[model samples]
Target chain A: MNTFTLGLVVVIYLLLTAYLGYVGFRQTKTSEDYLLGGRTTHPFIMAISYGAAFISTSAIVGFGGVAAVYGMGLIWLTFLNILFGIFIAFIVFGRRTRRLGRRLNAHTFPEFMGKRFGSRGIQTFIAAVIFIAMPLYAAVVLIGGARFIESIFAIDFNVALTFFTVIIAAYVIAGGLKGMMYIDALQGGIMFLCMLFILVMTYVKLGGVMGAHQALENMAELVPEGLRMKGHQGWTSYPAWGSEWWWTLTTGIILGVGIGALAQPQLVVRFMTVKSGRELNRAVLVGGIFILVVTGFIYTAGALSNVFFHRQTGQLAIEAAGGNVDRIIPLFLNSAMPAWFVYLFMLALLSAAMSTLSSQFHTMGSALGHDLLGTLFPKTRTNGMVITRLAVIFGIVVSMVIGYKLPGGIVARGTAIFFGVCAAAFLPAYIGGLFWPRTTATAVKWSIATGIVASLFMLVFMHGSESAPLGICKALFGRDVLVEQFPWMLVDPIIIALPLAGAVLIAVSLLTKHESALDV
Target chain B: MFGINSCGIWLGYLLAVLSVLLCVWYGAKKWNKDDDSAADDNWDSAETQLNENL
Candidate 1:
């Protein structure tokens, strides 16, 4: 746990990561290998890479902090993560995505959509949205990783940010998907083991599994007065239905994170990295267990951290962290975890951050170089790799700038907002394009446009979490939200926008003749 | 259930476990299945036609 030992550990980890990246670089002889891992990736590597990329430090630290405040009600999000994110994603969507990619020769998600719909305009538009909206998500992950580095190394924030960004950038830009997935598999393993230990150790610290839950249940009266008024029952119970807390938990956190997983460009692209349906089918087992352990343990440990904090200092986790939800997990670890484990957990957190960051950066680069720029300038197609590497650097720089400018306490909100937007903007079109041969290119265009506009409008004018800070509604309409009614503002954009997007897509698809030439 | 009184919360936990089991079963059952070629039968021809139209 000494500074020298921690430094040595980090150096060794970085060396391993660099070596993996180099291996990927050495293997890369063609554009296909750089972009899609030659479309023959091992099922285990593909599954773990997907899991690691999907579970970021934001999910662990930010949402875990939220679980500390909200109790085990977050178990629903974990359930949905396994069900929708892994099971349905792999079995239902992954198999078809692989086949479609192979058939269309698509290298990116936007490309897949564009080629499927036989519309260059749709591809450019999807790529444009990804290039524009994804940096905030990437920035938050960068911030999470950089902050951990800052605390562990006791360095300046800017220095940590630079070091973290540069290392991830080096690997992603040089090795591309192949290098990134190898590192992701390694990081995912670290995350899985660390979280498992944390879960068991937390139970041991809290006396036992059932005892911990019972104690938390007994502490229901200890719920803060404000949250109680919002209908918080206990650490072990759901919030009262129709209450503000219930709406936020169910709509904002649960639905947004759950359904949103289906449309993520980075995650969707992973399906294309494998060779066939069989690989995807085989991947479901590892992906399912990996997601369950990583997310399930964090939410469980986070909720139980309340008991640890309360018993140790007669303060709830939220109060002990002085009202900053993001600080609860770190505080709990510093307090309860052994020194050596804390040091080791730093690597796990680093893995979480870097794995997600690498994927986001890769997705952004592909969106730019392969989908947007390549379509806009046909000449750029010849040097697509070079263009993508440059775009990766651009994405990193933009994310770093945004990370420096963003305010605190935005981690969980930022994550949910991005997920909600992606869900509304991409999910309907993605699903329709995948399964419904009746889905027309024109309908997908309208659907995507509707999703983007509706979700943005809701974020700006209706959703209290985003609108309050954005202040666009307040400045224009003299209110924090267009609807001042209770529980309305807490409703996430995805709930309303996704339905609307799907309706538009379906209505348009039904009214128009199916374009058989573009049919899959 | 599991010291948690809320049916919804306990159900959520139980369902999370069961979902993983379902995934495992599904994966094991269909591990060697080769259905992609049939699904992709139209892809090559469709791509050729679409490219010509565009």
Candidate 2:
């Protein structure tokens, strides 16, 4: 790549972001405008912004790389993303979130829950969880983006991470959610085409789709000995049913992310941004299509990259690319793409990274400032904008510290932990609150608390893929799990905690039905 | 075991295409979907005191 061309592309991107930030700052007169776009965002912008924030570097570079190592089994996530992330989210959860939020005049996700359930404790607790857990997610996105930049620009990882953070943090602090959505929409468009190009070009390089899958399937004999020990069927097919691989794929990636998307505070807020039910309804197609292309292509291209690597270098994508799963996509592009194509692709990855990072920081800031602090101080609600801005800076500092400390190969699983935790802790109450009018505040409160406690307990002491690095089970119990080969240890927390959460909520709601507040 | 065939390989993308069509189809059918904008306006934001009421 020509240095001038690369520098020019970045300069243009930076300038455009600055202009977008300037526009957002001017438009944000009230906290309503700043936080929720004054509830008048168009459907196209809302859908694109939601999709962009929903699918970031984690989906493209992180999960895509995982697909390269694990084969196309990760594609199930794409199908589920459309079904749950788009359809169920926009049609089911989003409608109630928007309706109830506007009805309650709630501005933040926790505030929505707090108001709907009529409990300040609910707001504070969930806000605390976001402030504490969200940094890990932010760090993984930072690492994923920085790693890609480091690979291409030949810069130190710290420098790349810092550089990425500074640009996004500045814009997010100035623009808020309105500013973030505009940038997200722009970046989402860039990501759409770039991902499309990557898929088409990759398939073209390795013949066509069928030819590529056939080629990948042909390499099944080359499955690593270590993986084969744990029920490694070839990459293209689903893992052997009931095998460890199947457990990992079905529980960790597919169910973890698919269901998790519905409960995200950041995504839930986007539904309330637009004007009316019809506006949100109109967004269904746009969000679905954007997710289909960006997520669908990345997973597909990731799986097929092994074919390119094997045919060229006679090694699996991971081993030949220095064993860093995160580096597979970058390495694949460097080896196979033209300099110009690589240059454009870097911008797409940058867009993907920035779009999500800004959303994470913004949401975390709102959680701390608008929900937690606002509940405690209440006076801060008068100057909520200032508090939220300060909280954004605090979020960036925490994420930076985590980004610096994080080890390699933590990208995909790191993202999954945040998603799984959110699903386990938040999903039950959120759904119950929306659909079941009989869902009591006492039940919601207990359901959320117990769900979070159980999820945390499971994550720390169990041997699921996300918590595999925690080493708590091994250090304390001298084994991966307490009970040898426990099925619970292999699956993510949602499988256990979600059911438990529902049961607790249902059981408690029924027990308290005679004294229910809704009846009053 | 589906044997890593093209169906297992291609099912996601095919389903994704179907999902897009379904969303678009449903969205078009509901283009005149019932307006819930009245609810937002009916509840005044200036001084509702929903917070205190809670």
Candidate 3:
């Protein structure tokens, strides 16, 4: 509404986040406190914190925009998010990971890998990769948040970007993971309330559920000529079962986000923050309910936006936002909601972005400072906290540059790329290390190496777009590279690469004799 | 206005709430027993390890 009101709301939210960070800082005493909240975080806080970190601006802005363009079929992703991202993640992965982490006394993801496999070198390599790749994902999210601020406040993009980055970095550098999780829990609650309100309001604004569905069904006949030619018949119905649209929906959206959750280093580390399996078990329900509201509401509202905007403006809201799908949700909120609600929604969106951004920055910083450099130069003995703070600053700069320079429309693709790499490079070894007693350290090491090398080589050499990596796609594939041609790459490296990595681990473990000095 | 989608959403929430309540009940029941002797033994071992490290 008014500039002063909006500014006041923003300032108040920032102060609340800073206060939480201060509280976390006060409680933090050792590396354990900074890394894992001293392993005593309450169950409810841990659950919401984990959910908030998992469902970032990426899901709300990026995936929501995609849903607006693609139709309600993307709602399946929300279902998968609750089932896999929350339920399976907590039940299947969280309990075992917490136990193993305590057993190994590992704090960060890279440290977990290193200690599990008994190889300092493997941990260093994993840390280096995380440091290099995660910033791109972080930057894309920063851009999403900044763009919303620009739209609402009429602020410069660069200025908004810098402000968002600096605020998140300050608290994260000060409070570490404990600060990040406390703020995340609060943000998660805001996100749930905002989504509930938005969903109810959207339906009310559209008359009712039946009326909205009827309107969407009727609007299908009026599908644009270009979309019809490309096989989009309507927004009312599912895409043809065997069509390219169906493949993209199933492979690209559903499997990409769903399977990718397993290997997310940020989410995995949340397991280490609790004391026992019971705490993780308790968190499962909270996480599931949080996802059900947050993701379910976002998808529902996004799909309904098609009906609202099309009836009013004779076009989907995404098209109205100049084809930048990520801006669709913000644009809709600006147009549809009351002025005060817009400020509230902005706060929710900021919470979504900052919550995830803080976690990503913290994870990346630890990867660099504690895992990689710490392992490689063991005698350097630099203060770990100082190195981590500097790494956070470095990460912010890298992500900012990438966010500004990368061509737009890449947020969705960039998310797929990062998640795919994680699933491939880490999933096999991580799973085997936990469940399989015979998984040798050598086998684990080679599997990780193979998975990372193969996935990266595919991304750079075979899968890159025409402008990527010196036109290597045209040279190799004899056509401008299509992510669709090798759709497996777009899905997750895990499905293919995990099995391959598993095979290598098994074969190598079988061939090599067990060492007499093995610690385990 | 509360239709199938709302019903589904609420059902999910109820299931989650029930699960959480059960977990809290179970945790409290298990951990609130008179196990101070066992705890003391564990602490003694930890203290010995700390002394060795120092």
Candidate 4:
């Protein structure tokens, strides 16, 4: 907790990050190198960078807090992350993405889609969506990192936010994807080791694994009165089937994030960074283990923190953190671990935030500069690197402004909203483009358009979780939600829009003429 | 199995462990396989055309 020690640790970490950024900058010789790391990234680096970029403060701090409240049932997300995010994503999606990206000479996700279907309009539309929606996600991550730094360093939030933004911007602009990957690998390693240490230390503090879990189950009677009414079961157990809690856990958090990861622009581009399917295959081994330790342990540690709090203060984790779920993990860390580990965990968190932010900035930059502007104004294509670097700065500035402007509650929903929107908007077309050769460009256009429109509509009107907070429905319809009925209000936007979009795509593709002879 | 009583929660934990194993096995089996070369020849000219257009 010493200011001098904390300052020294941060300085060393930043200095190391700068060195990696410089390495990436020196290696980038062409636009291809800046955009896709020249298609020769190492498997270990690719996998770790992908995993680190995929996870953020949202997973560790935000979702970890949710686990403290929701219990180990959140582990289903971990299982799904490995099953879908790593296994299917790498083997099924990653292989095809690399092949198709190379075949089309596409550097960005939007460009891949645009070239695959031979429609620059499709490319521009997807890029526009990324530019508009991604800043919200970037802003929330910015705020999360800044808030943590504010709490730990006793600095102004503005100072923390600017420091975090500048560090990420420097690396991403100078090094591009290649530089970002190197930093991501380092950050990922710190995160994996720190999370492992916390998991082991937590279990040790609370008897052992089984003992800790059993202790949690024994305190089932202490479930908050309000939560029990909504089908709150013990922490170690799944929520009651068909209960409100079950729907929220299953459909909202688990399905929203778990399945939504496949189509992420930032994550997808990592697949295109490597040379061949062999590298992707090799990456799966490392990515699976990385996700398991980082995600699995945090969710487990979050749930088990209840036992520690209960033993120490006779209060649940939520109560111990004064009912703010966000504080539970930090409170547990400060209380349960030794002082030095807290500082190390802080570094892991900074790594988490920076890794994710770097990718977000890079993706946003490419979307605006490479995909949208470069396509629409052909002359801008000549200065692609300059345009992209300036776009990264624009993204950082937009995100920073939004970080200051947006209310606190909406920032918490930012990850879910962005993930759900991306899945609904991109997943159907992404799958069709990758696997189904019969898929028409017209079908992709409609599917993508429907996905974006329907998801946003659902968020604004029907899905109570987002709709209530957004207050647009209340302002317009004079009601909290468009539907006063049960479950409709509870459902996540992804559940409705993703299927509708897919159905539209399939139905339309069947009826329309096949436009391209290109086969996957 | 791990002192968690719920069958569903236990299944989740088991599946998560199983998934990691699956990735390891698949990766090891296919580590050196080059599956893209056959397709690379077909796309060579198309890739060239696309690059020129850009």
Candidate 5:
């Protein structure tokens, strides 16, 4: 817990991280190895790496703090993370994606989609969307990491942001996917062990598991007056079914991340990194368990932070975190965790943040260099690795700008917004492209455009949380929302746009002449 | 009908447990099955089969 000990531990972590990067760099001679680890990665490594990349500091620092405010209802998001994110992602999608990636020799998400549909336009459009939209997701991830570093290290925010960003960028740019996955496996292990300790220790800090829930139930009246007006029952409870808070929790967080997990271009491409359907099949249980433990423990511990805060400061966790929901987990650790564990958990949180950031940066770089620039200038194919490394630097700089400018409490919202947009924009075409041979490339184009337009319109005009600032109505009419109608502003864009995206894909596919499913 | 109370939160926990169970059940079945149909025996040959034979 002392400076000397903390310094020593961090050095050890850095040494190990560098060793993995070195091994990855050495083994990665060709572009293929850099991108997919020669397609021979161990299943356990793949599973843990997948889970770690999928659940980052956003789950821990950002959304965990929201758990402090919203209570156990956030657990459904965990359920969705496992059921949809891990279960279906690996079992349903991973098998076919791996098979097809080998079939078509596609290395990136846009490449995979473009090759699947046999459309250069589809590939270019996807590449452009990912290059543009992915940075926002990456920025929120960067912010989540920087926030934890800033809070715990007691450093200036910008300094912490730079420190974390530079560290992650060094390895990701140098070692590529091989380095990222190897590092992810290590970080995933640290996260698993630390979360297990946090769960047990938090219950001890409270009276016991059952007793903690009781104490929380007894403090229902302590729910913030604002949240209570919105239908909060207690720190241990869900909101009333149809309340404003319920809609936000259910539609925004749960559905946004739950169903939205399926369409994430980063996660989707992870399916292709393995050699065989058997490897992906073997990874399902390991990935599910990893996701369940990491997400389950964090959500549970985050909800219990309220009880811990009340015992410590006679205040709710959100209030004690100084009004930023993102700060709740960091502040709670400082107050509740043992001193030695505090330093150790710093590494765990770093693992949570860095593992995710590395993957996001990798995805952004691939989207830019391999998908966009590579698509534009096919002659630069020989310089693929150099182009990707350059894009990684660009992605990091763009991420740092947003990390600095983004308002507080936007971490979780930013993550969900991107996820929801992807669900609406990419999910329908992705699903149809995988399953239905009748899915025409032209139909998928319409689906993608519809998804992007509809989701953005709803987010800007109808969704209450984000609509205030960027909504069309606010911009045009100087009013809050386009419609003064009831509950129109209450629902998140995923609910509105996802169905429309799916419908468009179906309608266009049904009317069009089909090609061979494997024509690509 | 739903309230953020002890029972509701516990219900979420129960659902999470059920999901893990379902995942395990499905994963166990998938693991036990033989996937020889998609084995990575011959890399370029597999690509050729996929491109034309399939």
Candidate 6:
């Protein structure tokens, strides 16, 4: 597509998002309106908003790139995304969360946790963790969208990042959750259409399924001796059973992203926007179908792109785009897609990036403005609107700086780090508070504290490249750090930390007696 | 691009199975008309007590 047409499509989409923000600004009269859409969002809008926020450019770019490298095994992640992320998330978690949120009269995720458990301290601590950790994820998402724009349009990387940051921040700060949801619904629609078109076009370009597979199968015979030895025989087959690659595929990509959806604060807060359980139930199908298409199409096309690119060039798309796997989707779209589809695809990419970014910035700003500081100084009584707007600006600035400094793929990994932390810190408390009658404030606090401490210690001292310099894990364990030496450490912290946190919650609640001294 | 690949066919079948299961679950939950005498008894007695009081 010509630069002018592509830019025009993006500009029109931005204007539509801004118009939605304007509508939200007029409708919003109270802090509750700003935070939870006046507790009256419709099922369709709610479902799309939740789905859009749940699947960002990270899914399309980062994981798609990973698929280009790893092959069709990543499709399991897509299946789990629908079954767990959408289906179970909406029916099991969404209904209960909406009911409890309404009962507690909570606006934000931290507020919901705090009010449900009757602990101001728990709320503040969760807000603190969110504010501290979420920027990493937000920055990674920013990188994914900006990198795509830079690759397609040849714009400067920092310029693209800054433009995206400002556009998202404006709508979220001005319009709030209602505006975010409206734009999300629109973005969600565009994303669905774009994915469907890309998939069909890719199939047609490859001359149908049988022809394409035969070509890929023939090409598989030419796999480099080195890659064949490493177990990459072809892009046509699943990885060998019980291989190290298979484990990473199943655990890290599939289970990690799928299970991590349960504890995402930005997504959970969407449940609080609707009026009743019935509304959430109605949204279940809409949400599931949306995820089934967006995620399913993305993964299917990503896997198929292997054949198209490999047949044309001797290398996988990821290698064709240098060593950076995240660039594969953008490279394929720019080079292989029809010119007009490229224009539409830009809108899809914009929708994915902006929808998720607005929600992240809103969630981060609220966590900082409402929960953390509001708890420490009970008498402040500042207007939430003003405070939230300022916090949005603060969040945008911090995320942009991080986006500028970090490499694209590293930013993607950083997003996984935050999701893991949220699962560790909040999942037990969230699940227990909803189901267990005897869950206490003390247990909630202890569980959160332990989960946060363990995850942070591991992330800093064990997971990344600078592990040796940090060395907190080494100091504690008298070792070179288990995560670096063992592949299992890469994906094992959540298994250990989540159970430990849950055990603390259960044991502590059982051990301590209530202050009222009432019979159980 | 793998047009008639078995992988594609398997994926299609998997999706079809998923859709059918979802339909069956929703249909059974929404349309099932089995009687529950114990719950009915509780409701009948409660109605009777209210009528007597009136």
Best by DockQ: 4
User: Which runs in model 4 stand beyond 4 Å of their true positions?
Assistant: B45-54
lDDT at residue A72 of model 2 (Cα atoms): 85
List, in order, the clash count of every candidate structure. 0, 0, 0, 0, 4, 5
Which is the leading candidate under lDDT? Answer: 4
lDDT winner between 1 and 3, please give it.
1
lDDT of 1 by residue, B1-54 (tens): 878999979999999999999999988998888678666666667767988999
Best-fitting candidate, measured by TM-score? 4
lDDT of 1 at A377: 98
Worst 10 residues of 5 chain A by lDDT: A511-520
Per-residue CA lDDT of model 2 for A246-322, tens digit only, reads 88779877898888898888888888897789888889878888888898888888888999998898889998779
Model 4 lDDT at residue A395? 85
Query: What is the lDDT, from 0 to 100, of the residue A86 in candidate 1?
Result: 96
lDDT of 6 by residue, A1-520 (tens): 5778877887887778889889988888888888899989998899889999988887787777776676655666766777777777777787677766765678888998888877787898899888888887888888888887787789998898888788888888888898889989999999989888887877788877666656655666755666565556466666655555665566556766778788889999998898766566667667767777787677667767777777678677766888777778877887779878878877887788888888889999889878876678755436777777787789878888888887635656666667777888888888877777687888888888888887776666655333444676678776546555545554445666778889998998888754211111
Interface RMSD, per-candidate values to 1 decimal: 1.3, 3.4, 7.3, 1.1, 3.8, 6.5
Which sequence of candidate numbers ranks them by DockQ, best first?
A: 4, 1, 2, 5, 6, 3
Shift in Å, residue A19, candidate 2: 0.9
- Which tens-of-lDDT digit does each residue in A180-280 have in candidate 1? 99999999999999999999999999989889999888999899899998979888889999988999889988888999999999999999999888899
The CA-based lDDT of model 4 is what? 0.92
Candidate 2: interface RMSD in Å?
A: 3.4
TM-score against truth, every candidate = 0.96, 0.93, 0.86, 0.97, 0.93, 0.87
Worst 10 residues of 2 chain A by lDDT: A511-520
- Model 5 spans with C-alpha error above 4 angstroms: A404-409, A516-520, B1-7, B28-54
lDDT of 5 by residue, A236-353 (tens): 7788878888888888888888899898888887888887776777788788778778888878888889888888788889888778776788788878888888787888888988
Per-residue lDDT of A1-520 in model 4, one digit per residue for the tens?
7989998999999999999999999999889999999999999999999999999987998889988998999889999999999999999999999998997889999999999999898999999999999999999989989888898899999998998898899999999999999999999999999999999999899889889889988988899989887888888889998889998899988999999999999999999999988899899999999999999999999999999999999999999999999899999999999999888888999999999999999999999999988999999988889998898899889999999987775555889999999999999999999999989999999999999999999999998887887899999999989999887888889999999999999999999999853777
lDDT of 2 at A467: 52
